[model samples]
Target: MINLPMSAPTFIKSAEIYRSLRKKGITIRKTIDCLIAVLCLEHEVRLFRNDHDFLFIAEHFPLRIV
Candidate 1:
C-alpha cells in the first residue's frame, strides 16, 4: 500500500475537478471521492474502484480506472 499525502495543489485540483463535473451535470454524491480521483490523477496512479462516482471522474480526467 502506498501512503499518499494530500497537498495544497491536490486540494486545488480536487476543487477544480468537482466544479468541472458539476458544470457537466455530474453530481458526485461524495466530495471525498473527487479528492481521491485527484490523488490518482496527480500521482499517475491507476485506481481500482467499483464506485460509480469514479466513472464520472474518469470520463473527464486522466484517472485510469482498472
Candidate 2:
C-alpha cells in the first residue's frame, strides 16, 4: 500500500513517468534521482541538487535541478 498522504494518484504518476523514461532508454543510475525527478515533475517543484544524476534527469524530464 502507498503512503496515504501521497496515495494512488501520485504513485501512479511517478511510476508512469519512470516507466516511460525507461522505455525511452533514458538511463538514470540513481533511483533517488528518479524518485526526486518524478516528484518534481508531478508537483512542479524545483530541486536544488548538486548530484549529476539530477542533471541527467532534468535533461530528460521537466525537473529543474540546480
Candidate 3:
C-alpha cells in the first residue's frame, strides 16, 4: 500500500472519483481507490482502475490510468 497525507484534498478527491466511477458501471472498492491515489501521489506509479475514479484523478493530476 502507498502512503498519503491525511488531508481534505485526498479524501474529497478520492470520494468524488469513487462516486463517479460507481455511477459509470465500474467496480472498485473504496479501500482500493484510496490505495491507488496514494500510490499515484507517493510512488509516482501509474494506476489502472476499471473505475471512473481513476479517470477523474487522471484529469487533475499527472497520472496514467489504463
TM-score for each predicted model, relative to the true structure = 0.93, 0.62, 0.47
Sorted on lDDT, best first, the list reads 1, 2, 3
Cα lDDT tens digits, model 3, 1-66, are 544456666667666666665677754545566556755765567676677766655665567776
Task: For candidate 1, give the lDDT of residue 9.
Answer: 91
Report backbone clashes per prediction.
0, 0, 1
lDDT of 1: 0.91
Q: lDDT of candidate 2?
A: 0.68
Name the candidate, 1 or 3, with the larger lDDT value: 1
Candidate ordering by TM-score (highest first): 1, 2, 3
Best by lDDT: 1
Clashing pairs in 1: none
Clashing pairs in 3: 21-52
lDDT of 1 by residue, 1-66 (tens): 778889999999898999999999999999999999988887889899989999999888889998
Evaluate residue 13 in candidate 3 and report its C-alpha lDDT on the 0 to 100 scale: 64
lDDT by residue (1-66, candidate 2, tens digit) is 222245567667666666777888876676666666766776677778878777766776678776
**lDDT measured at residue 5 in model 1 versus the true structure, 0 to 100:** 86
The segments of candidate 3 whose C-alpha lies over 4 angstroms from its true place after superposition are: 1-3, 38-62
